[model samples]
Structures are given as structure tokens and as C-alpha cells.
Target: MLSLTKVCAGYGGFQALFEVSVEVEAGEAVAVIGPNGAGKTTLLRVISKLIGATSGEIRMQGASLARVPAHEVVSRGIAHVPENRRLFPRLTVEENLRMGAFPRAARKRYAERLEFVYGLFPRLEER
Candidate 1:
């Protein structure tokens, strides 16, 4: 589970998010829909620690992420797949997916994770 309470962040003096609060319970699907410049991306960036929140608290499974580095975010079961293409053009789809399991902890459960991924997007596995 993930929780964001009164999170506020911005670049320089431009405050993008103001007291944004969100809670994602286990197995819950929460959609963040907003127009451009609506701070949707900023909220995610703050949660992933890509950018620091000027104010607020972010917790994952009751563990505070105030001091957690961005690189360690994934180890906490929080992955931020940016909305951009960073794939290996020569690699197969499955191979590309496998690249995501590069971390030692993730690699240990590659097959299981792959199954879960494919279950969510069966077309990817078929291709």
C-alpha cells in the first residue's frame, strides 16, 4: 500500500502540487487523470522521489520514504516507469521485459513476476 498526505512540490518557485493527498490500497486501481500542467506527473515524481516534496509525507507499507533515495525506491516495491521509450530495439518483447528484472531481488522472482506482468497484458506475451 502507498499513501501520500498533504504533498506539495514544485520547481523553483512554481508550486505545482498543493496538499495533494492520495492513498492506494493493495490490489486497488487508482487513476490520476488531469489535463497537462495539472501536477499529475509531479505527484508521481514526488512519490518516486524523482523530485522532493516541499512538504508532506510519503509512506509505503507504513515505512516512511522521506530519506529514501530514488534508486532505492524500486527496492521498496515502488517502480516508476516513465512515459518514454527506453527500450532495446533489438531485444524481443520478453527480453525487454526481462531487463526490468535486472535487480538481484527482482531477478530472483523473474519468472513469477513475468507471469504477473503477462497476465496484465497478455498481448505482450503473445507478441
Candidate 2:
């Protein structure tokens, strides 16, 4: 579960999100529908710690993520895959997935993790 309470984030002096609050329960699918410049991307970025919230709090599973950095965000079970494929476009699907296990903590169990990932999404192995 993830919850954002009165989250306000912006770039420089331009505030993109104004007191935004959102809650995502486990196994629930939520969609963020909005036109361009509606802070949809900003909200995701803030939640992922790609950018820090100027004010308000973000909690995952009831634990505060105020001090969590972007790199640590993935380890916290949060990943921000934008609406683009600039990440290793030339690499094969498995290669790209392998790249995600680059962290020192993941390298030890890379093979096991890759197998788990492929098992969860069998299509990944086909690609």
C-alpha cells in the first residue's frame, strides 16, 4: 500500500502539484487520467522520490519515505517506468531486465531473481 498526504512538489518556484493526496491499496489498479501539464508525471516522480516533495508526507505500507532517495526507491518495491523506452532500447528484453539487477545487493542472486521474474511473466522469456 502507498499513500500520499497533502503532497506538494514543484520545480524551482513553479509548483506543479498543489496539496495532492492519493492512496493505492494492494492488488488495486489505479489510473491517473489528466491532460498534459496536469502534474500526472510530477505526482509519480514525487512518489518515486525522483523529486522531493516540498511539503506533505509519503508513506509506503505505513512507513515514512521522507528520507528515501531515488535509487533506494526501487529496493522499496517502487519502480518508475516512464511512458518511453529510452532504457537500453538496443538490448534484448532479457538483457534489459538483467540490467535492473545491477545493484550490488541484487548481483548475488541475479540468476534466481531473473528466473523469478521470467516465471512471473513468461512472455518475458520469449522475447
Candidate 3:
């Protein structure tokens, strides 16, 4: 339910993205992998509206996202996990995990989500 079409974005005036496009449908997971200077982050920044696109469009649920801000994208159910783990050091493993599902409604489903994450890393369950 997410897609980008020929999206272009950049810092200052020089363009980092050129005609970039991607799509992720409901129940489908898409990954972006590339070397440095591939504009991976820039594309995400454009999709999430963290950075404005110079051209083209990003859409969610068939609605245009033109000129939307970064914070607004979360309402569309787009969660961008950071590159590095950003768990709170002062919190225990469980607490840190809890923080990741900070949305109150999302938190209601945390038990299932926790089990899913833990199953992927059983060692974490032991921790």
C-alpha cells in the first residue's frame, strides 16, 4: 500500500535521487540494500517526507503525499526503523522492546509482537 514514483531528493541543490521508484503492498515486506552514495536513505527521506522530493510522488493507500511532513507519515502506518539499534541503555531488554511499540493502540498487540520478535531471537527471550 506504499509506493514511490520517479522520486528525486537531495541536500542543498545537488540531487541525490534520480527517478527512484519502489513499492510495498499490504502483507509484503520490501528491503532496500545498496552501497554508499546509492541514495537509499535519501529515497526513504523522500518517502517519509523527512526530506522534500524535488520531483515525482509518493503514495499510501492510493492517496497523494505531496508536501507531507515526516511526522504525518506515521499516521499512514509507515514505521522507519533506524539503521543502528536505538534502545534505551537504562532500560532492560524487555523495556527497550516495549518502547518500540510506543503507540498505545500498537501496544495493545505487543504480546503477539513480542513473541514474534523473541522467536526470531530466542537468545533474547533467555536474556
lDDT of 3: 0.81
lDDT per residue for candidate 2 within 19-88, as digits (tens), equals 9988999989899989999999999999989899999999999999999888888887787878686866
Q: Put down candidate 1 lDDT per residue, 38-76, tens digits, no spaces.
A: 999999899889999999999999899999999999787
Q: Model 2 segments beyond 4 Å from truth?
A: 100-125
TM-score of model 1 relative to the true fold? 0.88
lDDT of each: 0.90, 0.89, 0.81
lDDT of 3 by residue, 58-96 (tens): 899899999666676766666565566654567788887
Worst 10 residues of 3 by lDDT: 79-88
Best by TM-score: 1
lDDT of 1: 0.90
Model 3 ranges with Cα > 4 A deviation: 84-90
Return the top candidate by lDDT.
Answer: 1
